[model samples]
Target chain A: MPVIEVRDLVRKFGDRTVLNGVTFSVEKGETMIIMGGSGCGKSTLLRHIIGSMKPTSGSIKLFGEEITTMPAPQLEQLRLRFGMNFQFGALLQSLTVGENVALPLVENSRVDPAIIDLIVKMKLELVGLTGFENLKPAEISGGMRKRVGLARAVALDPELLFSDEPTSGLDPIMTAVIDRLTHDLTRKLDMTAVVVTHDMVSAFRIGSKMIVLGAGKRAGTIIAQGSPDEIRNHPDPEVRQFINGEPDGPVPLKLSPEDYIDRLLGHPRQKGVAY
Target chain B: MTLRAELRTFFFLNREILRWIFLGPFQGRPVRTAAVFRQMVRIGVQAFPMTALTSLSIGLTLAMQGAQELSRMGASAYVPNLVAVTILRELGPLLVGVVVIGRSGSAVTAELGTMKVGEEIEALEVMAINPVRFLVVPRFLAMLVMLPVLTVFGDYIGLAGGWTICHFAMDMGTATYIQRLMEAGHPLDLYSGMVKSFVFAWLIILISCQSGLGVSGGAEGVGQATTSSVVTSILAMLVANAVLTAVFFVF
Candidate 1:
């Protein structure tokens, strides 16, 4: 069975419909990359899949159990099976790096303190942050914080992982390192992953299956979905524009020049009129 | 948010805190006693010097004021009675409540609000750790246990301040002042003040934590929540003190 299945999910904030009838599923051991422009509901979709958000309508099933209406206690139980790495590190500022990573094991497991300490070191080493565990989050660089966040997320060796912009602020070399870790976790451990990222390189490097979300009028719906090669060579101009990082395309950047002038003047435009 | 909505959130959060404290242990999610102790040090032990200074000032001011007025009536010896009654029955808990609301209460709101905005609370949830259980309950337990202790300590310090004024200004012996103070105060006075402190502690922690957890936006939001938490907690404690005073008076 698919590890996660989102069907006809709709999320609305007042009159603004952020996500409109979006649907997708991820099978076990597959890495699904969700890519979109800013404010296109990439993270919103991820939040819903992870049960952090409740949809306005529709369903999300994790491990074949319906989770959209699950009670909080039950949802917490479901959370134990998966791990989510936030966009920023979101490491508790009050905790040391080792304490941050050890939080999950300490809270959820009955492991001995010595073993928990060992596991924390191992997780830190996985993220190349060994011997740096004694430092506070504020004492570290932004990139190091993000790596610590990853270590904390995977501390439990969860069966599934959800990462939001896992490589956004990192250098190209570190981005490759994180992408490799994602690859290793899924390939070696048979873990399922759903990542939301704007990093096309990282997306293409690790994504087994991919979905490109549309922006503007198309807002929360997928514009394209398939293998990396399929998305790379897709026929859709919008998809091509996003993947190639083109400045000019069908993607709307801002208000048109005429509209900008009209807005500033506080007047509706007349057809074919020069400002 | 509307007042009704704000109140609903407050009560809901209160219910969650109580549930986690009482029921979580049965579910094998017991409150972390270590975190509770850590929060006590932060909220209570660290707040000692400030509480001490404030209570001392209030006591000295009350004694001086009461002596001046009573001396005019040729009743200077009544100063001990006045100081003891006021400190033990009212100013003790009220002043300490204000101190805590200003110090630890605002801190709670700012800390929680930052956590909410940074998604640290969400991170805790995603790890199957309930934020209320892991975060709020510790603060709640700490405040509940420590506020009364602080209030009792403040009352004694305030009495000492009053004694300083009486012994030096009135030329009254310490034994005579102590005897008058004991004669003036009933056991109920201390109990009533303790009761008020407990209620104030509840309101302060609940308002502060709810404001923090409800924060959005960013740094500005944390600042706004902290301000609101302090203001609301003080107001709530004052109102509760009035009501409790009336209950004590009537009964």
Candidate 2:
């Protein structure tokens, strides 16, 4: 059985539906990537999977237990089995990187201080952040912060981990660095990971299975779900265009009537072409 | 959830408050001393000057009013005693409460609200640190500890201002005014003021910390929480003062 199972999940913000009847599951050790545009509900779906937000309908099962219907105390207890890396790194700004990394050990477990220190150092070193544990989040570069977040998420050796926009503000090289660290951690630790990202390159690097979310009425419906190469070569024109970064495609930019007319006049269309 | 769950949450929140206070002694773990101290200084120390100035000015005004009223009855000598009792018992405690609500109360709310928005609180929870115990308790302890000290300072400055105004401006004998103030004000009266100060401090911290933890939405949510903290603290302080006054006077 999958470690995490989300079935027909739905969420709406007032009149607008952000996630519309989405269903997916992450197996025990699979690195699944949820990919989409800015408002495509990838983060929303991730939130539900992590039990941060309640679904409008359907159910979420974590480790074969129905989480949505569990008591608050039980749910809190169940939360320890999972870890999440926020989009902005979300490391406690007031704490040193070491403190941030050791927080889970300090709070959740009664491990020895010596052991915690060793584990914290090891986790930071794994992310290539050795000896920089004394530095605050502000002192580190954005990519380093993301790495620290990854270290913290894996601090307790959780079976399932979720990362939201892990490469949001990093340079391309740094993005790859974070992506590789994530890929290496999952592979080496034999852990399950669900990553949400818009960076196609970073997504392709670590995503064993990728799910794409589209817009509007089908906001969170999986437009495509397969291996990276399979998604890149999808038969769906919308998926193909998005993958290739094409300007003129099935996903047309909505323009005002005056601007639409201007575009038509500025670049004279073929005689038989429709506006 | 049932009523039992609500009750459990209440007790849990209270226990969390005490946990943070006790945890302060064990500095081996990550201690947010600098942050707490900075917040206390910003909320308590920086607010001192304004509280003093307001207290002195208001004390002077109260003395002036007392002089005018008592003079009509040929009891102008009573003005010093009236102002002394008023400053130590009512004005000092109440004014400090209001100042803290504006200064520290709103600050606690905004800080916690931003932490909520940034998911720092949730991160703490996932790390198995109870956010209420980790964050709210320290703030609550700081405010509770500082307000009484600040109130005493405010009372001293206020009485001195009243003495100065009565001695010089109101044309009363300095020695006589001091005699009346010392004779009329009891140690019990001072005790009442101190007690009220502690209660007000608790109210300010409780309202601010609770409102902050209650924050939802985004940045706008934080702003709303800050406003709510101030308003609620002020209201709670006022009600607590009234209750304390009734107990002190009636009983």
> Which one wins on lDDT?
1
Docking quality tier of model 2:
medium
Residue lDDT tens for model 1, B57-115? 99999999999999999999999999989998999999999999999999999999999
Q: In angstroms, what RMSD does candidate 2 have relative to the true structure?
A: 5.5
Candidate 2 lDDT, tens digit per residue, B1-251? 35577446546676767655676357343445665676678778888988888888878888889888999999988988998899988998998788878977898889888888888987776665668767876676678778998999999888888888788887878788888989989988889999999988877887777778778999999998898778878887889999999999985
| RMSD (Å) of each candidate, 1 decimal | 1.6, 5.5
Each candidate: how many clashes?
0, 0
lDDT of 2 by residue, A31-145 (tens): 9999776788888888777676888898899998987777765776787888888888888887899999998888778899999999999999877899998999989987789
List the pairs of residues colliding in candidate 1.
Answer: none
Model 1 lDDT per residue over A1-275, tens place:
89999889899999988889888889999999999999999999988988888999999999999999899889988999999999898999999999999999999989999999999999888888999989999999998999999999999999999999999989998899899999999999999999999989899899999999998789888889999999999999999999999987888667788779888889988878776
TM-score list, all predictions: 0.97, 0.83
Go through the candidates in order and give each one's DockQ. Answer: 0.93, 0.50
Candidate 1 — what's its lDDT? 0.93
> How much is B135 displaced in model 2, in angstroms?
1.4
TM-score of chain A of each: 0.96, 0.89
